[model samples]
Target: MGKVLTQDAQRFMVDCLKAVGAGKKPALQQAELLIEADKMGHHSHGMNRLELYVNDIKTGKCQPNNECKILKESEATAWVDACNVLGATSSHFCMDLAIKKAGKAGVGWVSSKGGNHNGIMGFWARKAAKEGMIGMAFTNTSPLCPPTRGKQPVLGTNPLSVVAPGAQDELFYLDMATTAVAFGKIEIQRRKGKPLHPGWAQGTDGKITVDPEEASKARILLPLGGGEMTSGYKGFGLAAVVELFCGVLAGSKYGHHVRTWSLAEGGEPANLGQCFVAVNTSCFAPGFQDRVAAIMQHWRSIEPTEPCLRVKCPGDRERRNKEEAESKGTVTYLDSQIKSSAALAKKLNVTPMQVTAE
Candidate 1:
């Protein structure tokens, strides 16, 4: 592993974005989104994706400078067209609209079309949380998850996220794809030459497999509960609901119609759909924060079944990851990641990330 200063990583991402003709503000926004993913231990959405975004913009699949516009609007709802801009840019536009509506109407709901892969859903939700409101976000991706008891995939790994602030400096955060695991986990396992866990994926035959290579090639991830025996249909249904909020509501390419981005780039515009919502907590019953904090604290107080492990609330792991990374002022990346980033920098004529240690 190589440790790079956090600021250096951010700078490299910003520089690379600028090299791809992204404006300064959009570049910085995108870089910060990726860096926050690394800080939260979600490396799949971090610097590893820089090359993909660069390729997207270079191929004209994304217009970083395009302006998003409202197609229609109501007191507390809106429909938006992202105009094929970078994911971060569109997300910020949508979430800002949601926040403004929530401020006036107590709740805001916005659906967007013609979007890109917005690194982490939690980032959008946190934007609302920071404003002392409950925030929610959802997005639809390419088809990767098959329905329960079905052989062919027709639903994406649709993800949903929710975030809320609580008293005593606590936060309630939940963000996850409806699949048992993200496809990126399979990619990591394939790169490491390790077998996948049984519940993580299925092979081409559409049966569960522990082989990483097969799973990666099959590109078929299991639903959140794994198999029919484990009630995976529940996850399948939840994924569908997420899609309803994004693609269906926003009227974008949905389900099987969504194009597969895979690991490579240079495809048509993703035309993905996304949803953002914000609700002012003050508009609800009083003491919402105290109630949330009490529940979280109670969960943490539960006796652990294992001596080596302790109970945690939903956001505990990410909060801890961010704290540790910030305390050290650095992030550790796989040697391969560092090398690839260097190659990306060379390819784009941008300054490479400076490695402090290896």
Candidate 2:
């Protein structure tokens, strides 16, 4: 297995998936989405997730050939069924539809049910920002976080993301989970046999935990705040709001009722729900770009706590990361990760690459 740069690695990944049965366009899109995550410095949601997606396909939890359908539509909203297709494909389809509707109606909302993990939410939000619209997306998942005072994992790491387009170069974006950390973060630590920081999660009995492996099995992540006293209650509140939209509004499973991503034991998709909304700014104001530019300029002018660093907007770091990866021609991968990816490739009858392959 190799830790090839983002571009080459994604090309290989798309080719491998296409060879295995995914349609050309769908495979390519999925590969691009994952690689983009790596480039943006979020490895937990990047290629590491490809193994899960591929496994889901092999186990029949995610069908590469399934087609998503719009079950209902209205002037400002729609409901979609993924038909158990790959999450990336269904999410892209829905976001594109939402953008189209928003262009016509000034705003559009789309709710999707019966889909699996869709990777990072930023990818979809950025799609709308690129189209000159404000984009927002939210999703619910299997229980991974605990409520304010609970020790049991009673809530999904339900996440929300938003993107607002800027003038010419920058975009404002935010993507975060309702919990302090996602399951993937814990999983990564567990794989490395490392200890997690206190307050990130709680043991089964509601005690703070530091052992990642133990934490994964018996602990639940604390809500946005570690102990209720901190402002994490605000985060908890927002998380609940997302749950209402993704679960209650969509009539999907809520809180502890959701299912995990495992498939080997006959586990299927959690029938997760997601919400996507797009707002066309041109309908609301003329010269929106100029307005955005002025606001960001004012923000940057704020006195820096450290003179070496300048105040930056939300999307700036990601753009910088992408540029570095492109120029360097390679992205880093953990040694264990490369090995695991090799095993997966072999199991799927695909040839794995070396890091320095010409």
Q: The CA-based lDDT of model 2 is what?
A: 0.80
The TM-score of candidate 1 is 0.96
lDDT of 2 by residue, 1-358 (tens): 2458666678767766766678888888898888888888888888888877777776667777889889999988989987777778888988999999999999989998887788889899888999999999999877777667765676678889998888867688888888887766788799898988766777888777888977888748877776677765676677788888777777767777888765364675657788889999999868887788778778889999999999987777887887888888777777667778778778777767567532
Tell me the number of clashing residue pairs for each predicted model: 0, 1
How many backbone overlaps does candidate 2 show?
1
Candidate 1 lDDT, 181-209, residue by residue in tens = 99888988998999998888988787989
Where is model 1 more than 4 Å wrong at Cα?
188-195, 262-266
Taking all chains together, each candidate's TM-score versus the true structure is 0.96, 0.91
Top candidate when judged by TM-score against the true structure: 1
* lDDT over C-alpha atoms for residue 38 of model 2: 85
